[model samples]
Target: MNNAAQYDTVIVGGGPAGLTAALALTRYRHRTLVAESPAAPRNAASRGVHGMIGLEGATPAEVRARAWAELDAYGLTERRDTTADDIAPAPEGGFRTMLGDGTQVWSRTVLLATGVIDIHPDVEGFAACWGRTVIHCPFCIGWENADRTWGLVADDADYAAMAATGFRAWSADVIAIAPPGMDRAEETQRALRAAGSDLVQGEITRLHHHDGDLYAVEMADGTLIDRQTLLWAPPQRQVPLVTRLTDTLGLALDDDGFVTVGADQQTSIPGLYAAGDLTTAWEQGAMNAAGAGARAADAVHFAHPA
Candidate 1:
């Protein structure tokens, strides 16, 4: 059995959120370790990261590499490229984290940046088109695709209705794709139709694409909707690491199963904090996640000052 090491803070997940927190903790002089699993980032398929000022057109890999480069100069953060298996409250008023390789580490505080996984529908070519023509964030890809044929997929009526209206700003021709069992009220649907958009109420069987550039969305009943890009938010659930911890720790969760944190990003359980996608469902992206990490760092630092 490997002996447990000690640190002031231990951050799980090495995506943008975890990286940002590590950098903030280092600046605050907190000894920290970033424990990352082998799982690729949620945005790994993305060709470019947007909505982050000054980093326009930067690929996700480039953004991560650059963050690491800046952190390396400080030399105050230790990184472990492995999964954090479990976390238990130490008898001595700290945290004991078990790593995937049977190594245990102790820390005064633990931050969970463990992100969620998006569950796309079982449609052909959907996975392949992700991060490209299968648009996740309109703000991230809207400008380049301005005035192109666009599609909106949503399960909720209000969500689809609101999104359909908002999408008109990007393209006059919009198709709202509602999955099975989804329907908007007549007034809402009427309003959408009144705004120069069409609603397709059915499951999509396939997305036709060539080299990740979407060309058409195929409905289940042999209907083809020509579209250049589609905007959708697939369902999401917490990663296994997060699920286990939330269950064992009795952390409070929102309606959508996201960890409910205070403004400071501290979870209901003291000494345990969560940031990024694990903390919220709305406004998801690299930029929002990085900001959450900084907020959690501030709370952790304030809790235990140098």
Candidate 2:
């Protein structure tokens, strides 16, 4: 058998959460290996990392590169641009991970910074407008585009109504475009109208954009509505690694498909941890992911006191 290389921790991602956790461990002088996936990051479509102070408006790639650049200075953390193919509990109370290149590494603990996958609508122009004009969270990208015409394209009537009504703080012109056959509660409909939001029912055909900026939404009936941005919070699925872990290790997942974690980011399995959008459905931004990573790192560091 090949000798298993060991480290204090192995982070299964290299995005905001994984990089943040690696930084914390390096600060504490812990030996770590960050196995970043070869796949494109979840936020690659995002224009920039929003609502994160000190690093506001930075591109996702820029944020990750900046963090990874700091690793050389510490010399305590190692990085590999490879995916973690398999992870299994070690016989001696640690973990054995297989990299994409078939290298095996053992670690005392594993941090699953693997993020979630955002699902987008199946329509033309949505891809081009995504991250630039089509956004998911208002709080994350609303402030910059305030006062502009906004469209909430949601399948759930309750969420559509709530978002349309709630977005009034950002703009006076808010519209809830519900999918065909979706019905809203009377109370929600009243609230939307009271908030001065126009509610429309139709199948979104396409989002028209000019010069990469969103301009309007075209419906199946060929009706065009002028709008600058679309608030589309699509359902997200766990990354392959997270799903595999849940199946193989029996990690508990909440109804929303997020891995359940405690106050310190530890997963249902002891010594195994998770953070970022993979852990929650709300407050999922770069800043929150970084904070969660730091917290998870602290728990891992303190648990293995030197």
TM-score of each: 0.95, 0.94
Residue pairs of candidate 1 with colliding backbone atoms: none
Ten-residue segment with the worst summed lDDT in candidate 1?
Answer: 180-189
Q: Which stretches of candidate 2 lie above 4 Å from their native place?
A: 185-187
lDDT of 2 by residue, 1-306 (tens): 258888999999988788999999989888999998777887888777877778888988888878878887899999888999888999888899999978999998999998888887798898888777788888777887798889888777667776555777888788888877776545556777887776777888888899658888999999999999998877889878788888898999998789999998999999999989899989688889899999999999999742
lDDT of 1: 0.85
- lDDT value, residue 115 of candidate 2: 85
lDDT of 1 by residue, 258-299 (tens): 999999899888989999988887767788999999999999
